[model samples]
Target chain A: MVLEATLRGIRLVGDRTLRIVERIGATVAFLVMTLVHSATSFRRFDLVIREIFFAGVQSLIIILVSGLFVGMVLGLQGHETLQNYGSEQSVGVLVALSLVRELGPVVAALLFASRAGSAITAEIGLMKATEQLSAMEMMAINPIARVVAPRFWGGVISMPLLAMLFSAMGIIGGFLVAVVLIGVDDGAFWSQMQAAVDFRHDIVNGIIKSLVFGVAVSAIATFEGYEAPPTAEGVSGATTRTVVSSSLAILALDLVLTAFMLKGWN
Target chain B: MERSTLNLWVGVFVLLGFFAFLVLAFKVGNLSAGGNGTTYTLIAHFDNIGQLKERAPVRSAGVLVGRVKSVRFDPVHYNAEVQMAIDTKFPFPKDTSASVLTSGILGEQYIGLDAGGDEKMLKDGDEIKLVQGAVVLERLIGQFLFNKAQDSGADKGAQK
Candidate 1:
C-alpha cells in the first residue's frame, strides 16, 4: 500500500508539472495573438489612447512619492558611507548609478504590478466571470482584440515613462537630502553625476529594461485574467496570481538583462 | 471616459513623460551637445585603463573641458590608446599632463588634465605627451601588504 501511494504521488506531481507547462504555452500563445492584433488596431487609436491614461496617469502620484522617498534614503545612506571614505562629494554618482541601473526599473515595475497590473487582471477576470467575454464572442466581436490588446499596448507604453519619471524624481530627491540636508556640495553632486552617468549606456539600458518588463507584466496579467474560471473566487485568485507571478518575473528578467547588458564592464 | 478627456489626459501624460526623458538625456545623462562651441580631438596613451569607459569626462582643474571619445589597445606600444574631445572653449598648452582619476574611492574613472607652462597651445589631433594610467587600488593594497610583510621580517631579524 505504501509503495502504491508513492507511485500515485509521483504521478500526481508529473501531471501537475505538465499542466503548468500547458498553461505557460497557452499564455505565450495568447500574448502573441494580442500583440499581433494590437499592432494593426492602432488605427482605431482611441482605445489605446484612453487605456494609456488609465495605465499611466493613474499611477503617476504613487510613482513620484515612492521615487522621492527611495532617493532621499539613498542620499542619506550614500552620504554617510561616502563621508567615511572622505568621498562625500561622490553622493551624486552613487545615487544616479543605483537608481538608473537597478532601483529605478525594479521598484517601478513592482509598483506597477501591484497597482495597474492587478487592476487589469481583476477587470478582465470579472468580465470573464460575468460572461461578458462569451457574450462578445457570440456577437462575433473578438474580445482579445477589443479588450486585451489595447491594455497590453497601453501598459507597454506606460512602463518606460513611469520608470523615467521615477528615476528623475529620485535624482532630485537624492540632491535634496545629500546636498541640502546632509551638507554635501551641490556642485559636486551634479557634476560628479553628469561625469559618471552615460546616456547611451545607463539611461538607454534602463528604458529598454522597463519596456521589456512592461510587456512581460501586462502579458501575464491579461493571460491570467483570460484563463480564470468563471467564478468570483477565480477572478480574485487570478488577480493575486497576476501580482505574485509578475513580481517574480520582473526580478528574474532583471537579473538576466543585467547580466547581458553589463557583460563587458568588468 | 469621453474620447476628448481621455485624449487630453494622455496628451498631458505624454508631455510629462517626454520632459522626463529630456531631463534624463540632457541633465543626468549629459547627452546634450557641448554648449555653443565645437570640440576638437586629442589623443593619449596609458599603460592600464582600469575601468575607464567611453564618454568618461575629461576634466582640467576640476572643470569638465572635454570627454573621452574612444579607447583602443595599441598592440605596437603595448598600451591603451584613449581618444578625447576637448571643447574649443577650454584651450590648454601642449605640455599639459593627463591622468585617469577616480571621483571617489570606488567611483568611475575620468581623464584629468593638468595645465603645463608651454608657449604652444594644444590643437586638434595633438597628442598629450604626459599620460598617467589608472591607479588600481587592489595593486596598491597588494604592494602595501608586501612592504609591510618585508618590514615585519626585518624587524624580527633585528630582534634575533
Candidate 2:
C-alpha cells in the first residue's frame, strides 16, 4: 500500500507539470493570435489613445517618488566614499551614471509591471469570466483589437515616458542631496555630472529599454488574462502569472539590453 | 473605470514632469557646446587598460576640457593606447605630463594633465610623452595591509 502511494505521488507531480505546460502553451498561442489580429486591424486610433492614457499616465507618481529616493540614496553613499578620498566633486558623476544607465529603466519597468500588468490581467480575466469576450465575438467585434491593442500600445508608449521621468527625477534628487545635504558646491556637482555622462546615448538607450519592457509587460498580462479559465480560481491564477511572467521578462530583457548597449553599437 | 481615468491623468502629469525635467537638466546643468577652445591630444601607453572607458573626461588643473575618445591595444608594443581630445583653447606645452587619476576612492578613472612650460604648444594629434599610468587600488590596499602586519610583528618582538 505504501509503495502504491509513493507511485501515486510521483504520477500526481508529473500530471501537475504537464498541466502547467499546457496552460503556458495555450497562453502563448493566444498571444500570437492577438498580435496578428491587432496588426491586421490596425485602424484603431482611439485604442492607442486609451492605452497611452491608462498605461503611461497612471503610474507616474510611484516612478517619480521612487526615483527621487534612489537618487538620494546614491548621493548619500557616493558622498561618504568621495569624502574619504577628498574627491567630493566626483559624487555627481557617480550618481548621474548610476541613474542614467541602470537604475532608471530597471526601477520604472518593475513599477509599471506591477501597476499595468495587474490591471490588464484582472480586466481580461473578468471579461472572460462574464462571457463579455464571447459576446463581443458574436457582435462581430474583434476583442483583440478592442481590448488588447489599447493596453499593448499604452504600455509601449508609457514605459519610455516613465523611464525618462525616472531618470530626470533621480538626477534632481542626487543634485539636491549632493549640493544641499552633502555641502558640495552646486557648480562643481553639475560640472562633474556633465563630464561623466553622455546624455544622448544614455537617455536614448534608457527609452529603448523602457519600450521593450512595456511590450513585455503588456504581452504577458494580456496573454494570461485572455487564457484564464471561466472560474474564479482562473482569474487569481491569471493575475499571479501575469505579475510573475512580466517581472521575469523585465529582468531578463534588462540584462540582454545592458549587454547589447555596453557592447558599444553607438 | 474611474481608477483607469485616474491612472491616465497621473501618467500624463508624469510625462509633462519628465519633459520639464529634461529642459531643466540641460539648462541648469550647463550641458551645452560653445566655440572650440585651446586643446591638446595626449596618448598614454598601458599594459592593461583596466576599467577606463570611452568618453571618460580628461582634467587639467581641476578643470575638464576634453575626454578620452578611444582605447586600443597596440599589437606591436602589446600596450593599451588611449587617445584623448582636449579643447583647442587650453594650451599644453610639449613637456606636459599625463597621469590616470581616480575620481574618488572607488570612482571612475580619468586622465589628469599637468601643464608644462615648453616654448611650443602641443598641436592637434600631439601626444604627451611623460605618462604616469594608472594607480591601481588593489596594490595600494595590499601595501597598507602588509605595512600594518610588519608593524604588529615588530611590536610583538619588542614585547618578547
Q: In terms of docking quality, how is candidate 1 classified?
A: medium
Q: What lDDT score is found at residue A167 in candidate 2?
A: 79
Residue B148 CA displacement from its true place in model 2, Å: 20
Can you give the lDDT of residue A13 in candidate 2? 100
Model 2, runs deviating above 4 Å: A1-35, A39-42, A72-94, A174-178, A181-184, A260-266, B1-52, B85-108, B112-160
Model 1 lDDT at residue A201: 83
- The positional error of residue A228 in candidate 1, measured at the CA in angstroms, is 1.1
lDDT on C-alpha atoms for all candidate structures = 0.90, 0.78
lDDT of 1 by residue, B1-160 (tens): 6778888889988888889889978888767746324899999999999999887888898888988899999999999999999999888998999999998777679999999999999999999999999998899999999999999999999999
Error of 2 at B139 (Å): 11
**DockQ per candidate:** 0.54, 0.20
Report how far off residue A89 is in candidate 1 (Å): 3.0
